[model samples]
Target: MREWLGWLDHIESVEDSLNNIKARIKAFADNGGYPESFAIIYNGEIAGTVGFNDVNKFNRIGVVGYWLGEKFQGNGIMTKAFESLIEYGFRELGLNRIEVSAAIDNKKSRALPEKLGFTQEGERRQAEWLYDRFVDHAFYGLLAEEWHSDNRED
Candidate 1:
């Protein structure tokens, strides 16, 4: 996890990783607290993580966040991972909406939501604080109906 600091500015130490694991466990058990995180595997090797963040059960909404290792990117893996996640969110979790946001400058990360048919809503200025400075984020949203329309099998 330390090696991913370049792209994952949120992780700073071993303690952070341990704490994150604990939080993920708690989230999975609690069902509505923190984001439920999962390890993304590629060919049986750990590749990254994709999860539903800020889940609001009452509103049936959640935010999506993910990170992929540099070597694991560019193969349409994350896009497919997110596609399946969105389907699960709506079909199994009964969520009505899911949102994603990326730093405006992080074009690669920002592209996944767009590729998944998430509508570009707008930008949130300085919505995130990286290691050194604050960065603006571009927010995107997708409705369950929109997803079903695009992805449902006949």
Candidate 2:
């Protein structure tokens, strides 16, 4: 996790994890769920989380972010979770565009958006500083029209 999540690099105790959860909850409340997050539960345990961040209601855009536990990988959990999240983003949240980015080297992470029919927008050079070094990100985007057209039932 530390290899991908830089914030975990400094978490030395359980309290730090709890504090982070607290902060996420507070942010959800304070922002009226603009940055809504959901836990990915598998076998009654939290596999990970998926969320929308940097939401702009006026612009009808948001960024999707997610992480899955190692054990939860390859189980199709994140894909299903993303399917639901994207549905909600388009149908309920009324978003026109939803973007996602993954570290360019992280193939597993990058595969999700690609598999879900998101268009490869571009690359963000040195988009994130992960502890010791910087990491580039490959950006992907899905617009409401695109998603709807691709997902429509015949």
Candidate 3:
């Protein structure tokens, strides 16, 4: 968890974890669901999370974020989750553009957007501070028209 998600390293206890979860929920509500989140359930257990963060209704844009437990990888769980999320962002939230960014070296995270038909935009140098070091981000974006055209059943 600490490898990619450095925040987990700060959670020293179960209480801390609970508090973090609470804070996230509060932020979601406070922002009018701009950072809407969803838990990925696998075999009746929470396997991960997928969400749209940094949502801007005025600009009709949102950034996608997600993480899956090590035990849950390679099961196609995130792929399905993101598919639904992208649909929700466009169809329900009326978003015109959605973006995704992942550590340049984190292939699994970066692959989600690519496999979902998101176009690779560019890389942000030292975009995130992960624990003791910075990591570059590979940015990708998908537009509403692109999604609709690709998904339309002709």
Residue pairs with backbone overlap in model 1: none
User: Could you give candidate 1's per-residue lDDT for residues 40-150 as a string of tens digits?
Assistant: 899998888888868888999989888888899889988888877887788778899999988888888888998888999999998876767788889999998898789
My TM-score estimates for the predictions, one after another, are: 0.87, 0.89, 0.89
Residues 1-154 of candidate 3 have per-residue lDDT tens digits of 6688867777899999899789888977887765578889999999999987678889999888899999999989999999989888998888999999999999888888999899999999999999889999999999999998995642
Q: What are the per-model numbers of colliding residue pairs?
A: 0, 0, 0
Cα deviation in Å at residue 112, candidate 1? 0.6
Per-model CA lDDT versus the true structure: 0.82, 0.88, 0.89
lDDT of 2 by residue, 26-130 (tens): 977887665578889999999999988667889999899889999989989999999999988888788999999889998988899999999999999999999
- Residue 84 deviation, candidate 3, in Å? 0.4
Say what the RMSD of model 2 is. 2.1
Q: What is candidate 3's CA lDDT for residue 30?
A: 83
For residue 147, give model 3's deviation from the true position in Å: 0.6
Cα error of candidate 3 at position 91, Å: 0.8
